[model samples]
Target: MSIRGYLQILRPVNALVAGIAVLLGVLVAGGEVTPVLFLLVVAVFCITGAGNAVNDYYDREIDAINRPDRPIPSGAVSIRGAAVYSAVLFLFGIACAAFVHPFCFGIACLNSLLLVAYAARLKGVPLAGNIVVSYLAGSIFLFGGAAAGTDGLLLNLPLAGIVFLPMTAREILKDAEDIEGDREGGARTLPMVTGVLTSCRIAAVLAAGAVLLSLLPVVPWWGWWYLGMIALADLVILYAVASAFRCTTSACVRESGATSMLKTGMFAALGVLLFWALIG
Candidate 1:
């Protein structure tokens, strides 16, 4: 159970999903694939692992209070061990990114910095923490394109803003549900500022906007596959958002998180095929 829990801490599933989006973005941006993808994946893994370790470090107090079963506070892994691991991962991530491209290396630095900030300080701020995390979560895709020497092929600023901003809003909503754990741990997020219901409504609005934004890249530059995937993703996201709104309960929101994550994963999974086809 400890091994499994620690593996969950690694969040490999999320890393793989994020990697998919990155590869798709790279392909769409017309980057010639030559082992660059592998390097990018390694970089993602390291940075994400480091981020996990740092979060554990900063959240030690919170975990003791709210998540007593976690690795560090629960005696599964020593805090020193976790810190050393995090430092190693971060170093490895930087090295991997250095082999990719300067742009990607810079992005890795930013990601690590933001993760540390979120873990140490930003988490208590209203909405700020959620935005930081959401951007970090979605940035893997953007970095993939950047690594391939594509400035903004598949994931332009507009595209990223559209997808990530809404995701940030949703993250805030999640904080609201985790208020018990968060409040106990002394984190003051958006829901703490406004209210749970208000946060939920804000998430709904963002979800709707994300669905709409998925359609923007479907013009003459793109084709049927992109269109189809966008439609499919929009349908799935809209349904999940609607359910979250209608249900309006903590249990319901938790379920919606799973549903939304699944749908988001689907969207990322299908991106490669769509963008590969759209490459001019």
Candidate 2:
């Protein structure tokens, strides 16, 4: 396979974001940057890349219908090649995690397994897949904080909640976007089971909850910088919520770009957290 094909299969941008989230976890928990933290970041990058690659492999049939330009569906990478690449990346990630700390290594192992399971099975289950995805996203902070020590882990709990709620909402919207492919692939997602309107309502509630949780950091140690930035982030999420409410069907949700908007808002919130953690 070509280098570009391999890279495309890895979804490097998503993996890089996950790696950065790990770094933010360390920073927000008051952990210093160290060689160990760097290793943990690399570990997360590789693992996330591996997960994406494996997901591509498992979703090849669905992608053929929903995302024909994807590496596997486009014939940029062979199925076997993608599988091998994923295994290699998973190995490298676990090796890197093993050197960080036992707890971090454990998290890495557990996450790796969950990623595989999600691609193979849980992805088809209504609501279960959404929750798993949310947990995996939030656990990046926990994984980073664990690398620093116990206190770092404790300090990151609230940060994890801030991440979890919106991610769950986004996952629901994503399922809505992919409903046609999911239905053809014999998968039943939340939107498939509940209808897009009901699913969108649930997603809106979750986004609203995340906005509320985003306010809690100011109560602890954050100040005006966090308040202003987080308020902007909240507004972005609220806009996504409004978009969700307006979507009555899968096509409407996809056309509204609500899923991508939610992701933008999540990234904005993450950037705000990272900035404040660095300044403080």
Candidate 3:
């Protein structure tokens, strides 16, 4: 197996983004740069990479059609190798989390199991899959907060909500985008069962909810700076919602475009959180 193939299977960019999210979570909780915080970052990175690798393993057949360039489909990595790699990463992540705190270790174990279940079974189970994925994404903040203690986890709840809603919307949009491949793979996603128009409408509603949630007051120190920065993120999400709502037909469902905007808006929102955390 090529080293690059293993890295590609890990989807390092996405893994890095998850690692950064953990750091943001810690910062938002007013956590100092302790060694435990660093361990959380590493733990999150490995777990996220494991999730991606396992997903690629389970979706190898689908990738053959939807994404032939993926490591498994492109003959860069064997299916067994991918599975073994994921297992190793998951173990490493759990080990690192064990050093941080009991809460974090628990989260790591739960998330690791959820990730495997998501790829192996839930991914084909309509809205169930979307909810699981959303929870997993949102829990990254909770995981980091746990490193700071219980109060930090409580403080990060709103932040988790902010991430969860839009992520759910994006997951639905992605299902819509991959309807054909998903159908061929015998997966019953929301768009497949409910149709693209209905799915897009649901996604629009979820995005709108995220926009509303973004307006809630955060920590005292964030104050107006958070509001101003979050407003820009809200506008971007609003645009995505509008785009979703405009999809009157299956042919009109610009799923990729809408999802891309939502992702950009999420990154912007994360940036706002990071800025406030640093200054506060």
Candidate 4:
């Protein structure tokens, strides 16, 4: 397979974003930007890449119908090759984490297993899959804290909740988008079981909750800058919330605009954290 195919299998953009999240967590938890922090970022990135590869591997058939252009379904990569790549990346990621510290290594190991389980089985379950994926997203912050050698790691919980709510909403929207393929593939997703309208409502509520949780960080640690940045992020979230409410058709939810809006909001919130770390 071509190198480009391998990169595509890893979903490099998402992996890069995951790495950034790790760094933001480190910064927010007052972790010094040392070699160990760098190692943790690399570890998180590798496992995220592995997760992406394995997700494609397990969803190859579903992707063939829903996303025929994906690397695995489009003849760019073989199943066995993708599996091997995933295993190697996972091992490397875990090795990096082990070198950092016991706590980080433990988290890395657990996250890796959870990623595998999410891709291999949990994705087929309604709501459970959404929560698992959200937890994975939120855990990146915790992983960052552990890497930084912080005793106040629990401080990351508020931010984790902030991340979790929006991500859960986005995953639910994604499920709604992929309902047709999921149904054909025998995947029991929220939209497939509860119907798209109900799923949309649930996602909207979750988005709203995320908006509220975004303010929890404005304490002695964060100030006006955080509030201003989060307010901007909230505007985007509001737009996404409106979209979810207005979505009467599955096609509307399936379009990239719907989920893209939510992603933008989440990343914008992340940018706020990075900004706070730098100047606040």
Best by lDDT: 2
- TM-score winner among the candidates? 2
C-alpha positional error of residue 40 in candidate 2 after TM-score superposition, expressed in Å: 0.8
Residue-level lDDT of model 4, residues 1-280, one tens digit each, is 6788999998888888888788767777776678767888789889999999999999998999999999988888999999999999999999998987787899999999999999999998899999999999999988887765655357577778888998999999999888889888879998888888888889999988988877765333556667777889988987886786767567978663768898998888888777776564
TM-score for each of the candidates? 0.85, 0.97, 0.95, 0.96
Give candidate 3 misplaced runs (Cα > 4 Å).
Answer: 248-251, 254-256
As for model 2, its CA RMSD to the true structure in angstroms is: 1.2
lDDT of 1 at 158: 46
C-alpha RMSD values across all candidates:
3.1, 1.2, 1.6, 1.5
Q: At residue 182, what lDDT does model 2 achieve?
A: 91
Worst lDDT 10-window in candidate 1? 269-278
Q: Lowest lDDT 10-mer window, candidate 4?
A: 216-225
lDDT of 1 at 67: 74
TM-score for candidate 2, residues paired by index? 0.97
Ranking by lDDT: 2, 3, 4, 1
- The superposed Cα distance between candidate 4 and the true structure at residue 166, in angstroms, equals 0.2
Candidate 4: list runs displaced more than 4 Å. 217-220
Question: Model 2: per-residue lDDT, tens digit, 94-172?
Answer: 9999998888999999999999999999999999988988999999999988987897788788888888999999999
Candidate lDDT scores, in order, read 0.71, 0.89, 0.87, 0.85
